[model samples]
Target chain A: MQGYIVKRILIAAFTVFTVLTVVFFVFRLGPADPVMVMLPPNATPQDAENLTKKFGLDKPLMVQYGNYLKNAFRGDFGSSFRFDEPALRVLLMRFPATLKLGLVTFILSVTVGLSIGLISAVKPDSIIDRIGRLFALAGMSLPSFWVGIMLILFFGVTLRWLPIAGRGTPLHYIMPAFCMSLYPIALITRLSRSSMLDALKSDYVVMARIKGVPEFYVILVHAFKNASIPVITVIFGIFGALMVGSAVVVEYIFSWPGIGRLVMESFFARDYPVVQVFVIVVTCMVVTLNLIVDIIYAYIDPRIRYQ
Target chain B: MHSNQDNLLELQDVTTTFFTKQGEVRAVDGVSFSVGKGEVVGLVGESGCGKSVTSLSIMRLVPQPAGKIVSGRILFKNEDLMEKTAEEMRQLRGDRISMILQDPMVAMNQLLTVGKQLGEPYKFHDKVRGSLREMCIRLLEKVKVPAPESRVDDYPFQFSGGMSQRALIAMGIANNPDLLIADEPTTALDVTIAAQVLKLMKEIQRETDASIILITHDLATVAQICTRVIVMYAGRIVETAPIKIFYKNPAHPYSVGLIRSVPVLGQPVDRLFSISGQPPSLFAMPKGCRFAPRCNKAEKKCFKHYPPETWLDENHSVACWLYPGD
Candidate 1:
C-alpha cells in the first residue's frame, strides 16, 4: 500500500511538472510583455530594458525556464505585477477561501445527493421520487453562473435572507456554494440513484432482507455502501471540476476573493507569475484529487488491494 | 391449524404473482406444504419454476412494485404469518426464521467483515451485544471455517467460494431459528466444494435440530439431505412424499421423468431418460395440468381442465388427473 501511494505521488509530480511547462510556454506565447504590462504607459524603452534585465527577461529562454522551475519548487512563483507581492504568497493566502468553498459544496452535495438517491431507490416512483427527478433535471439544466445569479436575485435580493455577494460570515457562503454545487449534486443524485437501484437488487441486499435485517439497515448499510462506490468516483470528479471551473463563475459573481477571482484579476492585469502559479495550483489539485480517489477506492472496495 | 401441531411451517394455498408489462405471472400458484419440526424438506424444481419465489415468499421478501403475495396464508406454528404487521414480521425473521440464499459470491456484503456480517442476526433479533465478536467466531468455527479467529475479520473477497458459503450457513443459523431456508446453498460451487457445504449443512441441522427448507434443482442433493421432498413444475407442486417413497414410486409423470433423467453409476443405456418439451411459461400456462404438455402419460381430459391435488395413500400425494380427486 505504501508502495502504491509512493508510485502515485511520483506520477503526480511528473504531471505537475508538465503542467508548469505548458503554462510557461502558453503564457509566453502571448504578445504581452511582462515588463511593459507592469510599467506606466509613458515609460521609455530604457526603463523597459532595465525592468526586463531586472526580472531576467533578457536571459535565454532555457535559463529562465530552469530558474522558474527551481524557484517554483522553493515556493517562489515570482512577484505579481498588479499585487506587488509574491504571486505564490497571494494565492496561498486566497487558497483557504477556495478550499473552504470547495469543501462546503462537496459536503453539501454528497449528503443531499446520497440521501435523495437512497430514498428514490427504496420506494421508487413515489411522489417524492418524482420530485427528486425534477430537482435533478433542474440542477443539471441550469448553468452555475445563471443559477448563482438567480440565487442572488431570489435569496439575496428579494428575500434578503442572505447577503448579495462576498465571502465572510457563514451566510455569505450559502448562495455561491449552492450555485457551485448544483450540477454535481444533480449528477451524483442521478448516478447514485441508479447505482442504488442496482445494488438493492443485488443478492447481498436480498440476503440481508432475508436475514431479517430491518429495512433501514438493508437500505442504508448494505445497499448504500455498494451504491456509494461508484458515487465516490463521481464525487472526486466533481470536486476536481468544481475546483477548476464552477468556482471561477461562482467566485466572480459573488466577489468571493477566491483563487478563481484572483485568476481573473491577474489575467486582466497580465500578471504572468500569478496566472502561472494559479494554473500550476489547479494542476496539482487535480493530481492530488486523483491520488486521493485511488486511495479511497481501495478502502471502499476490498478487492482493490495494491500489490 | 391442524391436528399435527408439530409442524414448524405450513403454507396454505400460497400464491405469489408478479405484475409486468406483459401480464400477471403466477410465479408460485396455490403452493401448500407443511414442514415438521427438525425435518429437512427439499423443494425441487427446474429453472423459472418458482422454487426461488417460494423461498422468497416464505421469507416475505417478494420484490415490491412488481411481485406480490396475492392470496393465501403462511402459518408458522398455527399462527397465520400473513396477519403479522411488518414490524412483527421483522421480529419473527432471524429470530424464528432465517434464510441463506444461493450464490455465496453475491450473497454477502463485500465491504463488511465476516464478523460484522454474521453478527447482524444476533444484534437485530437476539439483541446479544458485547460478545458479538466471540459469537461470530463461534459460528464460523462451528461451520468449520479455518483460522476462525482471524478469518472473522476478513472481508468476503478474502474467503474462497466454499468458505463464503460456510460463512453464509453460519449467518443463517446465528439466531438458532426454528427454520433455516437454504436456497441452492451449493449450486454456485463445484462438486467437491458443494459436497462439503452440504455435509456442513446436515451436521449443523443435526446439532441445532432446526427445520430446513432446502431449495434446489438437483435431485441427488435432495436424496442426500432431505427426509421429505416436493417436486414442482411451472410454479405448482406436483408431488409430495417421504424421500424414499418419492424416489421409489413417483406418481406424477413429471417426477418420474426427472428421476429417470439422473444418470446412475455403472448403468448404461442407449439414451438417458429425459422429459420432452420446455417447461411452460408462467405468463402462458396451459388451462389443464401444467405438466401435461411434457408428460408422456397425459390423457385427453388432462388438456381440458387443471388437475386437482389428490392423496393416493396415507402419506403420499400427487397433482395429476390420473389420481382420483375428491
Candidate 2:
C-alpha cells in the first residue's frame, strides 16, 4: 500500500510538471504581452525594455522555461505584474475562499443527492421518485450562471432576504455554493439511484431481509454499502471537477474572491504568472484527490487490494 | 397431511401471485403442506415451478409491489403467520424461522465479514448475552469452516463456494430457529462439496432438532437427506409421500418421470429417461391439469378439468385422474 501511494505521488508530480510546462508555453505563445499590460499608457519603449529584461523576457524561451522550472521546484512562480507579489502567494490568498465554497458544495450535493437517490430507489415508481427524477433533470439542464442570477434576483433584489454577491457571513455563501452544486447533485442522484436499485435486487439484500434486519437498516446499511462503490467514484470525479474547473462562472457572477475568479481576471489582464500558478495548483489538487479515491476504494471494498 | 400436534409449520391454500406486464401469474397456486417438528421435508420440482415462491411466501419475504400472497393461511406453531403484522413477521424471521438461499456465491453480502453477517440475527433478535464474535466463531466451527477464529473475519469472496455455503448455514442456524428453509443449498457446488454440505446440514438438523424444508430439483439429494418429499409440477403440488414411498412407488406421472430421469449407477442406458414438452408458460396455462400435456397416461377427461387430491395411503397423496378421489 505504501508503495502504491508513493507510485501515485510520483505520477502526480509528473502530471503537475506537464501541466506547468503546457500552461507556461500557452501563455507565452499567445498574442497577449504581459509587459504591454504592465506598463502605463504613456510609458516609453525604454520602460518596456527595462520591464522585459527585469522579468527575463528578453532571454530565449528555452532559458526562461529552464529558470521557471528551477524556481517552481522551490515553490516560486515569479511575481504577478498586476499584484506586484509572488504569483503563488496571490493564488494562496484566494485558496481558502475556493476551498470553503468547494467543501460546502461537496457536502450539500452529496447529502442531498444520496438521500434522493436512496429514497427513489427504496420505493421506485412512487411519487417521490418521480419528483426526484424531475429535480435531477432540472438541476442538470439549467446552467449554473443562470441559476445564480435567478437566485440573486429572487433572494437579493425582490425578496431582499440575503446579500447577492461577495463573501463574508455564512449567508453570503448560500447562493454561489448552491449554484455550483447543481450539476454534481444531479449526476450523483442519477448514478446512485441506478446503482442502489441494482444493489437492492442482489441476493445479499434479500439475505439481510431474511435475517430479520429492520427495513431502515437493510436499505441504509446493507444495500447502501454495496451500492456505494460507483457513487464514490462519481463523487470523487465531482470533487476533482470542482477543484480544477472551480465554478468559474458562478464565482464571477457572485463576485466571490476564489481562484476561479482570480484566474479569469488574470487571464484577461495578461497576468501570466498567476494564470500559470493557478493551473499548477489546481492540477496538483485534482491529482491528489484521484490518489485519495484509489485508497478509499480499497477501504470500502474488501475485494480490492492495493499492490 | 401430517398430524397437527407435531406440526411446526403448515401452509393451507397458500396462493402467491405476480402481477407482471403479461398478466397475473399465480406462481404458487393453492398449495398446502405441513412440516412436522424435526422433520426434513424436500420440495422437489423443475425450474419455474414455484418451489422458491412457496418458501418465500412462508417467510413473508415475497418480492413486493409485483409479487404477493394473494390468499393463504401460513400457520407456524399453530399461529396464522398471514395474519401477523410486518414487524411481527420480521421478528419471527431469522429467529423462529430462517432461510438459506439457492446460490451460496451471492447469498452473502460481499462487503461484510462472514462473522458480521452471521452475528446479525443474534444482534437483531437480542438472543445472545455474550460477545457476538465468539458466537460467530462457534457457529463457523459447527459448520466445519477451517480456522474459524480468523476465517470469521474474512469476507465472502475470500471463501470458496462450499465454505460460503457453510457460512450461510452457520448464519441460518445461529438463532436455533424452529424451522430452517434451505433453497437448493447444493445446486451450485461440485459433487463432493455438495455431499459434504448435505452431511453438515443433516448433522446440524440432528443436533438442533429443527424442522427443515429442503428445496431442490435433484432427486438423489432428496433421497439422501429428506424424510418426506413434495413434488410440484408447474405451480401445483402433484404428489407428496414419505421418501421411501416417493422413490419406490411414485404416484403422479410427473413424479414418475422425474425419478426415471435420474441416471442410476451400474444401470447405464443409451439415452436417459426424460419427459417430453416444456412446462406451460404462466401467460398461457392450460384449462385442465398442468401436467396432462406431458403425462404419458393422460386421458381424455384429464384435458378438460383439474383433478382433486386422492389419498393413496394414510400419509401419501396424489393429484391425478388415474387415482380417482373417493
Candidate 3:
C-alpha cells in the first residue's frame, strides 16, 4: 500500500511536469505579442525592447521555459503583468471562492442524485422512477447558464426570497451551486441507476436474498456498495470538470471572484505570467483530482488495491 | 429408509411466471416437492427447465420486474414462507435456510476479503459484531480450506476456483441453516473438483443434520448423493421417485431418455442415444404432455389433453397417460 501511494505520487508529478511543458509551449505558439499589448501607443521602440528583455521574452522559448521551471520549483511564479503582484499570490487570493463553491455543489449533487437514482433503481417502473427520469432529462436538456438564470428569476427576482449573486453570505451559494450541479446530477443519476440495476441482478445479491436478508440489506449492503464504483468514477470525473468548467457560468452568474474570472481578466489584459500560471495550476488541480480518485477507487475495492 | 422425520420444507403447487413484453413465460409451472429433516432431495432438469427458478421462487429470490411467484405456498416447518413479510423472511433467511448458488466465482463478492465475506452471514443473523476474525478462521477450517488462519484475510482472487467454492459453502452453512439449497453448486468446476465439492456437501450435511435440496442436471450426481430425485421437463415435474427406483425404472419418457443418454464406459460405440428435438418454450407449451413431441411412444390422444399425474407405487409417480392403468 505504501509502495502504491509512492508510485502514484511519482506518476502524478511526472504528469504535472508534462502538462507544464505543454502549456508553456502552447501559450508561446499563440499569435499575440505580449510586449506590444503591454506598451502605450506612443511608447518608443527601445521601451518595448527593454520590457521584452526584462520579462525574458527576448530569450529563446526553451531558455524562457527552463527559467520558468527553475523559478516554479522554488515556489516563485513571478509577477503578473495585469495584477501587479506575484502569480502565486494572485492565484491564492481567488482560488478559495471557487474551491468553496465546487465542494458544496459536489456534495449536494451526489447526495440528491444518488438518492433519486437508488429510489428509481429499487422500484424501476414506479411513479418515483418516472419522476426521477423526467428530472434527469430536464437536467440534461437545459443548459447550466439557462438554469441559473431561470432559478435567479424565480427565486431571486420574482419571489424575492434570495439574493441574485455574490459569495459572502450563505444565500450567495444557492444559485451558483444549483447551476454547477445540474449536469453532474443528471450524469450521476443515470450512471448510478444503470450500475445499481446491474448490481441488484448479480448472483451475490440473489444469494443474499436467499439467506433472508431484508430488502434494504439486499439493496443497500449488497447492491449499493457494488454499484458505487461507476458512481465514484463519475463523481471524480465531475469533480475536475465541475471545478474547471463550473467556474465560467457560475462565476459570471454569481459574481464570485474565483479563478475563472481572474483568468478571463488576465486573458483580456494579455497578462502572460497570470495566464501561464493559471493554465498550469488548473491542469495540476485536474490531474491531482484524477490521481486522488484512482487511489480512492482502489481503497473502496480491495481487488484493485492488490492488483 | 423412512426416518419418520418432520418435513423441514415444502413447496405446494408453486408456479413462477415471468411477464415479459413479449409474453408470459412460465418458468416454474406448478412444481411441488418437499424435504424432510436431514434428507437430501435432488431436482434434476436440463437448462431452462425451471429447476433454478423453482429454487429461487422457494427462496423468494426471483427478480422483480419480470419474474413473479404467481401461485403457491412455500412452507418451512409448517409456517407459510410465501405469506411472511420482508422482515420476517429476512429473519428466516441466513438463520433458517441458506443457498449455495452456481458459479461460486461470481457468487462471492469479488471486492471483499474472505474474512469479511464469511463474517456477513454472522452479521446477517445478528450473531456477531465487529472483528469476526476468529469466526472466519473456524469457518474456513470447517470447509477444509488450508491455512484457514491466514487465508481468511485473502481476497477471492487469491483463491483457486475450488477453494472459492469451499469458501462459499462455508458462507452458506455459517448460520447452521436447517435447509440448504445448492443450485448446481459444482457446475462451473471440473469433474474432479465437482466430486470433491459434492463430497464436502455430503459431509457437511451429515455433520449438521441439515436437509438439502440439490438442484442439478447430472443424474450421476443424484445417484451418488441424493435419497430422492424430482425430474423436471419444460417447467413441470415429469417424474419423481427415490434415487434407486428413479434410476432403475424411470416411469417418464423424458427421464428414461435422459438416463439412457449417459455414455457407458468400456463399451463399444454404437449410436449414442439422445432425446430428439428441443424442450418446448414455456410461453407456447403443448396442451398435453410437454415431452410428447420428443417421445417415441407418444400417442394421438397425448396431443389433445394434458396427462394427470399417475401413482405407480408408494414411492414412484409419473405424469404420463401410459401409466394411467396403474
Q: After superposition, how far is residue A12 of candidate 3 from its true place, in Å?
A: 0.7
Candidate 1, position B263, lDDT: 95
Full candidate order by TM-score, most accurate first: 3, 2, 1
TM-score of each: 0.91, 0.92, 0.94
What DockQ score does model 1 reach against the true complex? 0.69
Best by lDDT: 2
Q: How good is the docking of model 2, by CAPRI class?
A: medium
Candidates 1 and 3 compared by TM-score, better number? 3
Native contacts recovered by model 1: 0.84
lDDT of 1 by residue, A109-189 (tens): 988987787788888999878999999999989988888888888988899899987777998888888888888888888
Q: What count of clashes does model 3 give?
A: 3
Query: On residues B298-326, what C-alpha lDDT tens digit does candidate 1 reach at each position?
Result: 89999989888898776788989888776
lDDT of 3 by residue, A1-307 (tens): 6678778889989988998788778877888887888888999999999999998998888899999889888877778877689987898899999889888888988998998899889989889889889989988889877888888899999999989977788888888888888888888888899899999889888876766666786788778888998898788855686667768767877678898878888878888778888878887887788788888878878877886
- Top candidate when judged by TM-score against the true structure: 3
TM-score of 1: 0.91
- The interface root-mean-square deviations, each candidate in sequence, come to 1.0, 0.6, 1.5
Scoring only the A-chain of each prediction against the true A-chain gives TM-scores of 0.92, 0.91, 0.94
Top candidate on DockQ is 2
DockQ order, best first, reads 2, 1, 3
Candidate 3: where are CA atoms >4 Å away? Answer: B1-5, B126-132
